[model samples]
Target: MAVSLGVFSGMRFVAAQPHSGNLLRSVTMAVHVPRKGLGKPGRLLVTSATVSETPSSPKVRGIMKPRKISTEMQAICGVDEISRTQALKQIWAYIKENNLQDPENKKIIICDEKLKKIFAERDQVGMLEIAGLISPHFLK
Candidate 1:
Protein backbone atom coordinates (compact mmCIF):
# COMPACT_ATOMS: atom_id res chain seq x y z
CA MET A 1 0.00 0.00 0.00
CA ALA A 2 1.15 3.51 -0.72
CA VAL A 3 0.31 6.45 1.48
CA SER A 4 0.39 10.01 0.20
CA LEU A 5 0.79 13.10 2.33
CA GLY A 6 -2.12 15.37 1.31
CA VAL A 7 -0.08 18.51 1.78
CA PHE A 8 2.63 17.47 -0.70
CA SER A 9 3.02 14.93 -3.52
CA GLY A 10 5.08 12.58 -1.33
CA MET A 11 4.49 8.84 -1.21
CA ARG A 12 5.58 6.02 1.06
CA PHE A 13 5.12 2.26 0.75
CA VAL A 14 5.23 -0.43 3.39
CA ALA A 15 6.37 -3.94 2.69
CA ALA A 16 4.20 -6.83 3.79
CA GLN A 17 5.32 -9.07 6.60
CA PRO A 18 5.52 -12.83 6.15
CA HIS A 19 2.22 -14.64 6.85
CA SER A 20 0.59 -11.30 7.76
CA GLY A 21 -2.58 -10.34 5.93
CA ASN A 22 -2.32 -6.71 6.92
CA LEU A 23 -0.22 -4.37 4.77
CA LEU A 24 1.48 -1.80 6.94
CA ARG A 25 1.50 1.61 5.30
CA SER A 26 4.36 4.02 5.89
CA VAL A 27 4.91 7.52 4.58
CA THR A 28 8.37 8.92 3.88
CA MET A 29 9.36 12.21 2.35
CA ALA A 30 12.50 13.56 0.70
CA VAL A 31 14.11 16.90 1.38
CA HIS A 32 15.18 19.05 -1.54
CA VAL A 33 18.32 21.13 -1.23
CA PRO A 34 18.02 23.70 -3.96
CA ARG A 35 21.23 24.72 -5.72
CA LYS A 36 22.41 28.32 -5.55
CA GLY A 37 23.11 30.55 -8.51
CA LEU A 38 25.62 29.08 -11.08
CA GLY A 39 25.00 25.58 -9.67
CA LYS A 40 23.43 22.66 -11.49
CA PRO A 41 19.90 21.49 -10.72
CA GLY A 42 19.70 19.30 -7.59
CA ARG A 43 18.26 15.79 -7.48
CA LEU A 44 15.55 14.52 -5.15
CA LEU A 45 15.06 11.03 -3.69
CA VAL A 46 13.38 9.26 -0.80
CA THR A 47 15.44 9.27 2.43
CA SER A 48 13.72 6.36 4.17
CA ALA A 49 16.57 3.92 3.49
CA THR A 50 19.49 5.97 4.87
CA VAL A 51 20.42 9.25 6.49
CA SER A 52 21.99 11.94 4.34
CA GLU A 53 25.37 13.39 5.25
CA THR A 54 25.17 17.16 5.69
CA PRO A 55 27.79 19.71 6.66
CA SER A 56 27.59 21.38 10.03
CA SER A 57 25.54 24.56 10.07
CA PRO A 58 27.46 27.81 9.92
CA LYS A 59 27.83 29.80 13.13
CA VAL A 60 25.18 32.46 13.66
CA ARG A 61 26.35 36.03 12.94
CA GLY A 62 25.01 39.06 14.81
CA ILE A 63 25.94 41.80 17.23
CA MET A 64 26.32 40.83 20.89
CA LYS A 65 23.36 42.78 22.28
CA PRO A 66 24.05 44.24 25.70
CA ARG A 67 21.81 43.03 28.51
CA LYS A 68 21.49 45.21 31.59
CA ILE A 69 21.29 43.57 34.97
CA SER A 70 19.26 45.28 37.68
CA THR A 71 21.28 47.14 40.29
CA GLU A 72 20.28 44.70 43.05
CA MET A 73 20.67 41.62 40.86
CA GLN A 74 24.02 42.87 39.53
CA ALA A 75 25.33 42.73 43.10
CA ILE A 76 24.24 39.06 43.40
CA CYS A 77 24.65 37.71 39.86
CA GLY A 78 27.79 39.20 38.39
CA VAL A 79 27.92 39.25 34.62
CA ASP A 80 28.89 41.33 31.59
CA GLU A 81 26.68 41.48 28.48
CA ILE A 82 25.00 38.07 28.23
CA SER A 83 22.33 36.45 26.08
CA ARG A 84 19.35 34.83 27.75
CA THR A 85 20.92 31.37 27.38
CA GLN A 86 24.15 32.37 29.09
CA ALA A 87 22.28 34.12 31.89
CA LEU A 88 20.34 30.95 32.69
CA LYS A 89 23.53 28.87 32.81
CA GLN A 90 25.17 31.19 35.33
CA ILE A 91 22.03 31.36 37.50
CA TRP A 92 21.66 27.56 37.56
CA ALA A 93 25.33 27.18 38.49
CA TYR A 94 24.93 29.61 41.36
CA ILE A 95 21.87 27.78 42.68
CA LYS A 96 23.59 24.39 42.54
CA GLU A 97 26.84 25.62 44.11
CA ASN A 98 24.85 26.96 47.07
CA ASN A 99 22.51 23.91 47.32
CA LEU A 100 19.43 26.06 46.80
CA GLN A 101 17.33 23.43 45.02
CA ASP A 102 14.52 21.87 47.07
CA PRO A 103 15.54 18.41 48.35
CA GLU A 104 12.09 16.87 47.87
CA ASN A 105 11.43 18.42 44.45
CA LYS A 106 14.39 19.65 42.50
CA LYS A 107 12.13 21.69 40.22
CA ILE A 108 11.38 24.00 43.11
CA ILE A 109 14.25 26.30 44.04
CA ILE A 110 14.46 27.79 47.51
CA CYS A 111 15.39 31.44 47.40
CA ASP A 112 17.53 33.34 49.88
CA GLU A 113 17.22 37.08 50.53
CA LYS A 114 19.03 37.89 47.30
CA LEU A 115 16.83 35.69 45.14
CA LYS A 116 13.73 36.65 47.11
CA LYS A 117 14.27 40.31 46.26
CA ILE A 118 14.84 39.51 42.60
CA PHE A 119 11.87 37.12 42.61
CA ALA A 120 9.57 39.57 44.38
CA GLU A 121 9.22 37.94 47.84
CA ARG A 122 8.48 34.40 46.67
CA ASP A 123 9.97 31.92 49.17
CA GLN A 124 10.11 29.20 46.54
CA VAL A 125 9.54 29.21 42.79
CA GLY A 126 9.60 26.82 39.88
CA MET A 127 12.59 26.80 37.54
CA LEU A 128 10.55 27.84 34.46
CA GLU A 129 9.05 30.88 36.17
CA ILE A 130 12.52 32.07 37.10
CA ALA A 131 13.13 32.95 33.43
CA GLY A 132 10.27 35.50 33.35
CA LEU A 133 11.27 37.13 36.62
CA ILE A 134 14.92 37.30 35.76
CA SER A 135 14.33 38.55 32.23
CA PRO A 136 13.11 41.91 33.55
CA HIS A 137 16.46 42.42 35.24
CA PHE A 138 18.12 42.06 31.81
CA LEU A 139 17.71 45.11 29.59
CA LYS A 140 18.45 44.86 25.87
Candidate 2:
Protein backbone atom coordinates (compact mmCIF):
# COMPACT_ATOMS: atom_id res chain seq x y z
CA MET A 1 0.00 0.00 0.00
CA ALA A 2 1.21 3.46 -0.97
CA VAL A 3 0.20 6.47 1.16
CA SER A 4 0.26 10.19 0.29
CA LEU A 5 -0.73 13.19 2.39
CA GLY A 6 -1.82 16.67 1.30
CA VAL A 7 -3.84 19.61 2.59
CA PHE A 8 -6.69 21.44 0.82
CA SER A 9 -8.98 24.17 2.16
CA GLY A 10 -7.32 23.97 5.61
CA MET A 11 -8.26 20.24 5.79
CA ARG A 12 -5.68 17.49 5.68
CA PHE A 13 -6.24 14.60 3.29
CA VAL A 14 -4.45 11.29 3.16
CA ALA A 15 -4.70 9.09 0.11
CA ALA A 16 -3.91 5.37 0.16
CA GLN A 17 -3.65 3.39 -3.04
CA PRO A 18 -3.49 -0.40 -2.77
CA HIS A 19 -0.71 -1.96 -4.84
CA SER A 20 -1.31 -5.36 -6.41
CA GLY A 21 1.60 -7.80 -6.96
CA ASN A 22 0.31 -9.44 -10.18
CA LEU A 23 -2.97 -7.86 -11.35
CA LEU A 24 -3.63 -4.13 -11.54
CA ARG A 25 -6.49 -3.63 -9.03
CA SER A 26 -5.46 -0.37 -7.36
CA VAL A 27 -8.18 1.64 -5.57
CA THR A 28 -7.29 4.96 -4.00
CA MET A 29 -9.00 5.93 -0.75
CA ALA A 30 -8.94 9.25 1.07
CA VAL A 31 -8.69 9.67 4.83
CA HIS A 32 -10.97 12.46 6.00
CA VAL A 33 -10.04 14.50 9.05
CA PRO A 34 -12.89 15.37 11.32
CA ARG A 35 -14.18 18.96 11.23
CA LYS A 36 -14.67 21.05 14.37
CA GLY A 37 -17.48 19.63 16.57
CA LEU A 38 -18.34 16.95 13.98
CA GLY A 39 -17.45 13.70 15.80
CA LYS A 40 -15.82 12.33 18.87
CA PRO A 41 -12.11 12.65 19.56
CA GLY A 42 -9.66 10.28 17.82
CA ARG A 43 -12.10 9.52 15.00
CA LEU A 44 -11.40 9.68 11.26
CA LEU A 45 -13.61 9.64 8.17
CA VAL A 46 -12.60 7.64 5.10
CA THR A 47 -13.84 7.65 1.53
CA SER A 48 -12.86 6.80 -2.03
CA ALA A 49 -11.54 10.12 -3.30
CA THR A 50 -10.76 8.80 -6.79
CA VAL A 51 -14.11 7.08 -7.30
CA SER A 52 -17.10 9.05 -8.61
CA GLU A 53 -20.11 6.89 -7.95
CA THR A 54 -23.48 8.38 -8.78
CA PRO A 55 -25.77 8.43 -5.74
CA SER A 56 -29.15 6.79 -6.16
CA SER A 57 -32.19 8.85 -5.26
CA PRO A 58 -33.29 8.40 -1.65
CA LYS A 59 -36.36 6.24 -1.00
CA VAL A 60 -39.54 7.97 0.16
CA ARG A 61 -40.75 6.07 3.22
CA GLY A 62 -42.17 6.79 6.68
CA ILE A 63 -44.07 10.07 7.17
CA MET A 64 -42.30 11.66 4.23
CA LYS A 65 -43.95 9.33 1.70
CA PRO A 66 -47.12 10.74 0.16
CA ARG A 67 -50.29 8.70 0.51
CA LYS A 68 -53.99 8.89 -0.26
CA ILE A 69 -55.95 11.17 2.07
CA SER A 70 -59.62 11.38 3.00
CA THR A 71 -61.96 14.09 1.76
CA GLU A 72 -61.77 16.01 5.03
CA MET A 73 -57.95 16.01 4.85
CA GLN A 74 -58.19 17.00 1.19
CA ALA A 75 -60.31 19.97 2.21
CA ILE A 76 -57.55 21.32 4.48
CA CYS A 77 -54.46 20.29 2.46
CA GLY A 78 -56.02 21.27 -0.85
CA VAL A 79 -54.72 17.98 -2.24
CA ASP A 80 -56.13 14.46 -2.56
CA GLU A 81 -52.76 13.00 -1.50
CA ILE A 82 -49.98 14.28 0.73
CA SER A 83 -47.24 13.32 3.21
CA ARG A 84 -47.79 13.68 6.94
CA THR A 85 -45.16 16.39 7.10
CA GLN A 86 -46.76 18.31 4.25
CA ALA A 87 -50.23 17.78 5.72
CA LEU A 88 -49.04 19.27 9.02
CA LYS A 89 -47.58 22.23 7.18
CA GLN A 90 -50.89 22.88 5.43
CA ILE A 91 -52.82 22.57 8.69
CA TRP A 92 -50.44 24.94 10.49
CA ALA A 93 -50.77 27.39 7.62
CA TYR A 94 -54.54 27.29 7.93
CA ILE A 95 -54.36 27.70 11.70
CA LYS A 96 -51.99 30.64 11.47
CA GLU A 97 -54.00 32.27 8.69
CA ASN A 98 -57.24 32.08 10.63
CA ASN A 99 -55.64 32.77 14.03
CA LEU A 100 -57.32 29.70 15.46
CA GLN A 101 -54.90 29.30 18.37
CA ASP A 102 -56.26 30.49 21.69
CA PRO A 103 -54.93 33.92 22.70
CA GLU A 104 -54.64 32.96 26.39
CA ASN A 105 -52.82 29.64 25.72
CA LYS A 106 -51.06 29.43 22.40
CA LYS A 107 -50.78 25.64 22.70
CA ILE A 108 -54.56 25.32 22.79
CA ILE A 109 -56.29 25.28 19.42
CA ILE A 110 -59.85 26.57 19.24
CA CYS A 111 -61.25 24.70 16.27
CA ASP A 112 -63.39 26.90 14.09
CA GLU A 113 -66.10 25.78 11.65
CA LYS A 114 -63.50 24.75 9.05
CA LEU A 115 -61.24 22.83 11.47
CA LYS A 116 -64.27 21.21 13.14
CA LYS A 117 -65.02 19.36 9.95
CA ILE A 118 -61.73 17.46 10.18
CA PHE A 119 -61.33 17.42 13.97
CA ALA A 120 -64.58 15.41 14.35
CA GLU A 121 -66.59 18.44 15.48
CA ARG A 122 -64.36 18.89 18.53
CA ASP A 123 -64.73 22.39 19.95
CA GLN A 124 -61.10 22.63 21.10
CA VAL A 125 -57.90 20.58 20.94
CA GLY A 126 -54.46 20.71 22.42
CA MET A 127 -51.34 21.32 20.36
CA LEU A 128 -50.03 17.75 20.86
CA GLU A 129 -53.45 16.32 20.00
CA ILE A 130 -53.23 17.69 16.46
CA ALA A 131 -51.13 14.78 15.16
CA GLY A 132 -53.42 12.09 16.65
CA LEU A 133 -56.63 13.86 15.58
CA ILE A 134 -55.45 14.21 11.99
CA SER A 135 -54.14 10.64 11.64
CA PRO A 136 -57.61 9.22 10.80
CA HIS A 137 -57.90 11.65 7.90
CA PHE A 138 -55.02 9.86 6.15
CA LEU A 139 -56.62 6.83 4.52
CA LYS A 140 -54.74 3.52 4.85
Candidate 3:
Protein backbone atom coordinates (compact mmCIF):
# COMPACT_ATOMS: atom_id res chain seq x y z
CA MET A 1 0.00 0.00 0.00
CA ALA A 2 1.04 3.59 -0.71
CA VAL A 3 0.24 6.76 1.25
CA SER A 4 0.85 10.41 0.45
CA LEU A 5 0.88 13.64 2.47
CA GLY A 6 1.37 17.29 1.56
CA VAL A 7 2.12 20.49 3.46
CA PHE A 8 1.00 23.98 2.55
CA SER A 9 4.63 25.17 2.32
CA GLY A 10 4.93 23.14 -0.95
CA MET A 11 6.49 19.98 0.48
CA ARG A 12 5.17 16.55 -0.43
CA PHE A 13 6.05 13.20 1.19
CA VAL A 14 5.09 9.76 0.00
CA ALA A 15 5.53 6.35 1.65
CA ALA A 16 5.13 2.98 0.01
CA GLN A 17 5.14 -0.54 1.42
CA PRO A 18 6.67 -3.53 -0.31
CA HIS A 19 5.07 -6.97 -0.44
CA SER A 20 6.73 -8.79 2.41
CA GLY A 21 5.73 -11.14 5.24
CA ASN A 22 7.12 -8.75 7.86
CA LEU A 23 4.98 -5.63 8.42
CA LEU A 24 7.82 -3.83 10.27
CA ARG A 25 10.13 -4.06 7.24
CA SER A 26 11.77 -0.96 5.79
CA VAL A 27 9.38 1.19 3.70
CA THR A 28 10.25 3.33 0.69
CA MET A 29 9.82 7.07 1.14
CA ALA A 30 10.16 10.09 -1.17
CA VAL A 31 10.34 13.78 -0.42
CA HIS A 32 9.74 16.50 -3.04
CA VAL A 33 11.19 19.94 -2.38
CA PRO A 34 10.20 22.94 -4.50
CA ARG A 35 12.84 25.08 -6.15
CA LYS A 36 13.55 28.49 -4.63
CA GLY A 37 14.95 30.36 -7.68
CA LEU A 38 12.74 31.65 -10.48
CA GLY A 39 12.20 29.27 -13.44
CA LYS A 40 14.04 26.55 -11.54
CA PRO A 41 12.80 22.99 -11.31
CA GLY A 42 12.14 20.97 -8.14
CA ARG A 43 13.97 17.82 -6.95
CA LEU A 44 12.83 14.47 -5.59
CA LEU A 45 14.77 12.55 -2.87
CA VAL A 46 14.15 8.94 -1.96
CA THR A 47 14.85 7.36 1.42
CA SER A 48 13.74 4.56 3.77
CA ALA A 49 11.13 4.80 6.55
CA THR A 50 9.74 2.83 9.50
CA VAL A 51 6.25 1.49 9.91
CA SER A 52 3.50 3.72 11.37
CA GLU A 53 -0.30 4.09 11.36
CA THR A 54 -2.01 6.21 8.74
CA PRO A 55 -3.36 9.65 9.58
CA SER A 56 -7.09 10.03 10.20
CA SER A 57 -9.38 12.51 8.46
CA PRO A 58 -9.49 15.98 9.87
CA LYS A 59 -12.59 17.10 11.78
CA VAL A 60 -14.63 19.96 10.36
CA ARG A 61 -16.04 22.50 12.84
CA GLY A 62 -18.66 25.23 12.84
CA ILE A 63 -20.50 24.35 9.64
CA MET A 64 -23.74 26.31 9.16
CA LYS A 65 -26.69 24.24 7.95
CA PRO A 66 -29.18 25.49 5.35
CA ARG A 67 -32.28 27.27 6.65
CA LYS A 68 -35.82 27.78 5.31
CA ILE A 69 -36.50 30.78 3.08
CA SER A 70 -38.62 33.74 4.17
CA THR A 71 -42.24 34.32 3.23
CA GLU A 72 -41.38 36.94 0.59
CA MET A 73 -38.78 34.66 -0.95
CA GLN A 74 -41.21 31.79 -0.86
CA ALA A 75 -43.74 33.91 -2.76
CA ILE A 76 -41.11 34.94 -5.29
CA CYS A 77 -40.02 31.34 -5.70
CA GLY A 78 -43.63 30.12 -5.67
CA VAL A 79 -42.96 27.70 -2.84
CA ASP A 80 -44.07 27.63 0.82
CA GLU A 81 -40.56 26.92 2.12
CA ILE A 82 -37.30 26.33 0.30
CA SER A 83 -33.56 26.22 0.84
CA ARG A 84 -31.36 29.15 -0.19
CA THR A 85 -29.71 26.99 -2.88
CA GLN A 86 -33.12 26.05 -4.30
CA ALA A 87 -34.24 29.70 -4.24
CA LEU A 88 -31.16 30.73 -6.25
CA LYS A 89 -31.75 27.90 -8.71
CA GLN A 90 -35.37 28.98 -9.23
CA ILE A 91 -34.32 32.61 -9.70
CA TRP A 92 -31.71 31.59 -12.31
CA ALA A 93 -34.35 29.51 -14.09
CA TYR A 94 -36.66 32.50 -14.23
CA ILE A 95 -33.86 34.74 -15.53
CA LYS A 96 -32.96 32.25 -18.27
CA GLU A 97 -36.60 31.75 -19.22
CA ASN A 98 -37.10 35.51 -19.63
CA ASN A 99 -33.68 36.17 -21.25
CA LEU A 100 -32.91 38.64 -18.49
CA GLN A 101 -29.14 38.41 -18.96
CA ASP A 102 -27.59 41.46 -20.62
CA PRO A 103 -26.48 40.77 -24.20
CA GLU A 104 -23.41 43.01 -23.91
CA ASN A 105 -22.28 41.70 -20.52
CA LYS A 106 -23.73 38.43 -19.32
CA LYS A 107 -22.86 39.28 -15.73
CA ILE A 108 -25.45 42.06 -15.76
CA ILE A 109 -29.06 41.00 -15.37
CA ILE A 110 -31.58 43.23 -17.18
CA CYS A 111 -34.66 43.39 -15.03
CA ASP A 112 -38.00 42.92 -16.79
CA GLU A 113 -41.47 43.87 -15.54
CA LYS A 114 -41.72 41.04 -13.04
CA LEU A 115 -38.07 41.31 -11.96
CA LYS A 116 -38.37 45.07 -11.46
CA LYS A 117 -40.54 44.50 -8.42
CA ILE A 118 -38.00 42.13 -6.85
CA PHE A 119 -35.01 44.24 -7.85
CA ALA A 120 -36.34 47.50 -6.39
CA GLU A 121 -37.25 49.02 -9.82
CA ARG A 122 -33.68 48.85 -11.11
CA ASP A 123 -33.37 48.46 -14.89
CA GLN A 124 -30.19 46.43 -14.53
CA VAL A 125 -28.23 44.76 -11.72
CA GLY A 126 -25.01 42.77 -11.42
CA MET A 127 -25.36 39.02 -11.05
CA LEU A 128 -23.28 39.00 -7.84
CA GLU A 129 -25.58 41.65 -6.27
CA ILE A 130 -28.63 39.46 -6.71
CA ALA A 131 -27.88 37.57 -3.48
CA GLY A 132 -27.67 40.74 -1.41
CA LEU A 133 -30.78 42.21 -3.06
CA ILE A 134 -32.82 39.10 -2.33
CA SER A 135 -31.41 38.82 1.21
CA PRO A 136 -34.04 41.22 2.57
CA HIS A 137 -36.81 38.99 1.23
CA PHE A 138 -35.43 36.03 3.19
CA LEU A 139 -36.39 35.35 6.80
CA LYS A 140 -33.72 35.57 9.46
CA shift of 31, model 1, Å: 16
Candidate 1 lDDT by residue in tens digits, 1-140: 33333334333333322233433332344443334563456554445542233334655433234466777676566865666666677778888988999999999999988888888889999998988888677765
Worst 10 residues of 2 by lDDT: 17-26
- Cα lDDT computed for each candidate against the true fold: 0.65, 0.80, 0.68
* Candidate maximizing TM-score: 2
Model 2 TM-score, all chains together: 0.64
Model 2 over residues 72-140: C-alpha lDDT tens digits?
A: 788888989999999999999999999999999999999997799888899999989999888888888
Ranking by lDDT: 2, 3, 1
Instruction: Identify the runs in model 2 with alpha carbons over 4 angstroms from their true place.
Output: 1-54
> What's each prediction's clash count?
0, 0, 0
lDDT of 3 by residue, 19-101 (tens): 66654544545564655673347555444445664445554332232455655556558876566666788889999988889
Error of 3 at 102 (Å): 1.0
Which residue pairs overlap in candidate 2's backbone? none
Worst 10 residues of 1 by lDDT: 11-20
Model 3: C-alpha RMSD to truth? Answer: 9.7
TM-score for each candidate, following the candidate numbering: 0.52, 0.64, 0.49
Off by over 4 Å in 1: 1-64
The C-alpha RMSD in Å for every predicted model, in order, reads: 14.7, 10.4, 9.7
